[model samples]
Target chain A: MSQGDGIYPDDLKYTKEHEWLAVHGSIGTVGITHYAQSELGDIVYVEVPAAGAPVVGGEEFGTVESVKAVSEIFAPVSGEILEVNPALAAHPETINRDPYGDGWLLKIRLAEPKEIDALMSAAEYRKYIEEEAN
Target chain B: MPPAAGPLKTTPLVRLFRDMGARLVDFAGWELPVQFSSVIEEHLAVRGAAGLFDVSHMGEIEIRGRAALELVQKVTCNDASRLGPGQAQYTVLTTESGTYVDDILVYRRGENEFLLVVNASNTDKDFAWIASWARGDVEVVNASARWAQLALQGPKAVTILQGLLGGPLDSLRPFRFLETEVNGTRSIVSRTGYTGEDGFEIYLPPQAAADLYQALLRAGGPHGLRPCGLGARDTLRLEARMLLYGNDVDETTTVLEAGLDGIVRPAKGPFIGSDSLKREKERGPARRLMGFEMIDPGVPRHGYPIRVGGEASGAVTSGTVGPSLKKSIGLAYFPARAALPGTRFAVNIRGRDALAIIVPTPFYRRPH
Candidate 1:
């Protein structure tokens, strides 16, 4: 999505910090939402935890740096990292281009799947960001 | 977040910027556009063609009277006596200990009159300093609110601005300015800019700024003159190795240590920091601000700890993934002995050390 264009797929859950999680059984995929990447202007660098690292809910797992500022990425639920996007380091701009699809930051094996209930749904996250922009 | 004083101040071009879809952000307590499109796009636009900027937030001070030159000479480090009418020089307002009060551009309007363009956040402080030193026949007035500034910079800058002037701008040498009519509005047009490009900085009455801003955009549309914001400005100036005041140099850093010995002229006379500068020059500064590029994977950020030869020395002052060079470059203070072209250091980014090497700066010099 481009600037001012908002897209929140109903299959995903989002955090107040703007990371989106896609759950499938015991595994989940994570990436920053389109709203977050647009607000960042341009992504130049990204640092993520290695696979098998433990992540806690609402805790910082990595950092996303744009041309002007740096933003910390917080996990929405507790999990163990399964895999990280190896292509993200050299092509950080991919997050700004295809944030939801190819720009996924990491894959995790859920440690507390019930924690997903606390995340905002697509419709709620859309409203959450709309309120944030004001 | 809003500053403690009140809402962020807006420039005269704020509405126009919003109309053009600019992403506004708070910069030094002023609300200004960070970018219209993207930093990389705007940065390359200035390098390839031209880019316009609303720099109206910058402070302007007029020093007028018989002792104008003397008051300016006493406060600033550069020798303002060498400047004649229509000439300008980049100088610094120094403190008693030879540290920077602020960096400014001194423009000589006449033998007994001058104009100082200073940083936006340092306006009141700089004015107070200049006013206190105002003895004899000098008058210091903060004319910041009375003017609006527009910088049209890059290779095509001259061509884009020449049509607005009644005379040619081709003959206006760098650092020279003239009081002329811009789009029929009385303005000060200077052949100087921070982007290291051939350009003009036009200072106009606030009332005439909005209309002139649009006119220039219309005239420059064909030349690919995109309206840039502070994001591009920062990146462009970084590539040129121009230092930002609050970040690169502050009260703790002396002019000599900031790599600005060329502007310190103690031999001319005793200015605010002249005595201290002279002492420091004789002994040589212990530390100096130097440029470096990360050799390992990580981006150096401001306030990041820096280690020179494995010992904690200083902090990163200004850093970014250079939009032009595509390298993580930054400026940092290091021990004088370690300030060399090939000297290697480590930047502590969130407790992780990233190896970096000092490199020759003005990292991306444009082809002449």
Candidate 2:
């Protein structure tokens, strides 16, 4: 915790693109990692798909723009939107101030259960960003 | 090292930021030092006291000849006919459809010499556009390669500049110039700036740039002329209600629609965009540019959907959490009816509704 904001938890599965997924059987809670949101700074706008909108694996799901630049948010696996973060609409900077609690972007029902095991673990994902940054 | 794709180019004070371990961002193809320092702190410096800007990258195009004034009047939005020698005016280069090519400052130096300082990226394009339309004997010259530009701006700018120039500089009115010597180096000093503060913009050769920068840094050292980057430049201009060309006004956005009707002279004879501009001025635009504040948490940025009646009307051109105002403010084009100040609307930020209100242009204005 002293080395800046720490990685979320060992149980969470993370994509190389900085998205994290918590799998409870087939239903998944998908959101950008605390690391991703911190790098992006204040989240001014989020552009996730509709609740019923079907998103494909490795496809662009939405966009998030900060004051300086705009970035595309990608889906790690094919999924359907279950619920979106309603609190983010008013307090988007919570992603920067506190990403794990209030900054979780959306919840989705996964189409592929096998994709979870393919993602890196908290320890591995933390190492990945460090390597990527280098 | 992964086959380095050429070394990055740095300006005079690039080493300062490098030593501080700053993130150098690429802006308009130039490897510029983004934040020395923090964005908000640099931003507040310009708003409160002073900020030094290395606007050397901006291009200067000189329209020279006996027909220079006439050519300028024909090509730009400002009425250059009324301007005497040694006067400057804010103007926009428009297409035949009255759409903006680029906004620039027209400086009338002599009977036949006029300088048009424009945005950096648009330098080649703007020169090509002017060269294509140029009919008279007046030769349009790209003088940017010959000079560097610097902006010394803020509330304390006058005091700092007055001392640097060896006397009072406030006598030069807005959009006016003074042929002065700094360290005995000839410089063209203007009382105009992109920031809303009362400041001076100095133009000189490359060799003289370093000395002037250092002299001002030493003279205004206590007065707070901190070296500001492109980040603060963008924030300050947006707050002052100055339009960004590519964002706020583009090839598709007309001068009238951009709310720059005051600068467009439709009756100034047969120039480009005269007919289209006249018609638009008479008919009024369907969607108009407006300034608004975010009522929700999300800051309204460019391309965010603007909702009028639960549907998309237009989009935001620029938006940010104004450090000075402590609130999210931005500009967008919407239905003329909803363009009213205090009119509330919604911006679609990530499939959610972020409340917004139409406020008057310029979320910040400096005291005249």
Candidate 3:
């Protein structure tokens, strides 16, 4: 997906806090959207929950820090963290350069598959950001 | 929630910043750009090449009369009697309780006239405080509205400024200023800056700010001069270890504890905070400001608690990722015993304790 101008893949589900989820079977890959990274300016540091940590939906799972400020990353759905992006520890700027690819924050095993339906679709997420900008 | 309702004051360069798609924020009642581009990019640009900054929000006060020096010496911690014409001194407006009223630059304009450039947020308070001290033979005038200021800073600063000046600028020493015309606009160009780099600060009439800004941008475009904002300015100054008034020092922070003892000369004799400062110097400050770098992968921010041996020791004052050094560095006040370089401490970053160690400041010193 071209992230040059705020691309939101229709195949993924998004949270109001700008986290996007790509589900593969029972595992869901999570990363911040291009808009989130752009609004953050430069990603200097990111702290994610350890693998096996329980993540509750609508709860903070981690934090994204820019040079200017710190923002909390919210969990899109209840799940168990399976993996974290180890590459982020050394090169957090990858979140700004390629937020959806190498910058994926974590992979999780969904505790409730029905929770995915609560997230917004790609079109809804686009409109949500438009309202926020206005 | 709806946006807070209030009219924001703007500098002459507001439209220019808006035109450049600068991210504007409300700072001390003034609508100013927080960043023109990205903070790191603008910060690196200033360190490698040059960056232009709109610093017109800073307040300027003029003191003129036979007693100008006396009034200045009474309120400031530095000895102004030693300054001759064209020289500037980094000083502080101290309160009677031995705390900082504001950190300012004392520019000796003439034998009986001086100018004080102070922080933006403290302008009104400073004016009132200084005016209260003015008596017979001394006149304090708030000239903030009459002037605009721009800082051109970095390694290429001199070369870029030299291109627009009619006279030789190589002779202008650091901390000294020259009153001259730049592209026909009257200005006071000073070899001073907060970025820990060689640069010049141009103070001119508000009406001439826009024109000079554009002219300098056009002249400096080929040389890689980017228009920076407060975000870059903060990171640059943090790397330089320059104290910000509200963050690093405030009405509660004394000059002695702020690690600015070099600027305080008690031997020069009686000032507003002299008595308390003298006592503090003799007895030694209980707490001292120390610079530390995070040993872990978290950013230590302002108001975060600093821990020593699992116990709270102090609180962070100013913290940021030092772009030049590419590390998380910050300033904090620790007990005298724990303020030494190499002392280990941990900062509470969002409930997680991030290990840090005290280090010698000016985290990123420019190559000479």
Query: Which structure among the candidates has the greatest DockQ?
Result: 3
Model 2 chain B weakest lDDT span, ten residues long: B1-10
Q: Model 3 has how many clashing residue pairs?
A: 0
Model 2 CAPRI quality: incorrect
Give a tens-digit lDDT track for model 3, residues B1-368: 12236898899999988888898989878899988879999999999999999999999999999999999999999999999999999999999878999999999999999999999889889999999998789999999999899999998888999988889999999999988898798799999999998999999999999998998898888899999999999999999999998889999989999988888888898999899999999999988998999998889888999888778876899999998898999999988877899999889997888899999987888998
- CA deviation > 4 Å runs, candidate 1: A1-6, B1-4
What tens digits encode model 1's per-residue C-alpha lDDT throughout A35-125?
Answer: 9998898999999889989999999989999999899999888989999998898899999999999999999999999999999999899
The pairs that clash in candidate 1 are none
Positional deviation of residue B180's Cα in model 3 after best superposition, in angstroms: 0.4
From the highest DockQ down, the ranking of the candidates is 3, 1, 2
Worst 10 residues of 1 chain A by lDDT: A1-10
What DockQ does each listed candidate score?
0.81, 0.21, 0.89
Error of 2 at B215 (Å): 3.5
Clashes of each: 0, 2, 0
**Model 2 ranges off by over 4 Å:** A1-66, A69-130, B1-20
Model 3 stretches with alpha carbons more than 4 Å out:
A1-6, B1-5
lDDT string for model 2 (B1-368, tens) is 12125665445545555664555776766567565555566788988899888888788998988777777878887688878988999988989898988999989899889989998878888998887777767899887778888899988888887876754686788889988886568899998998888888999887778778778877787988787777778888889889998889988998888888888886677677888888888889877898999877666778888889777887889888776776788999887777688888999875778898988878898765
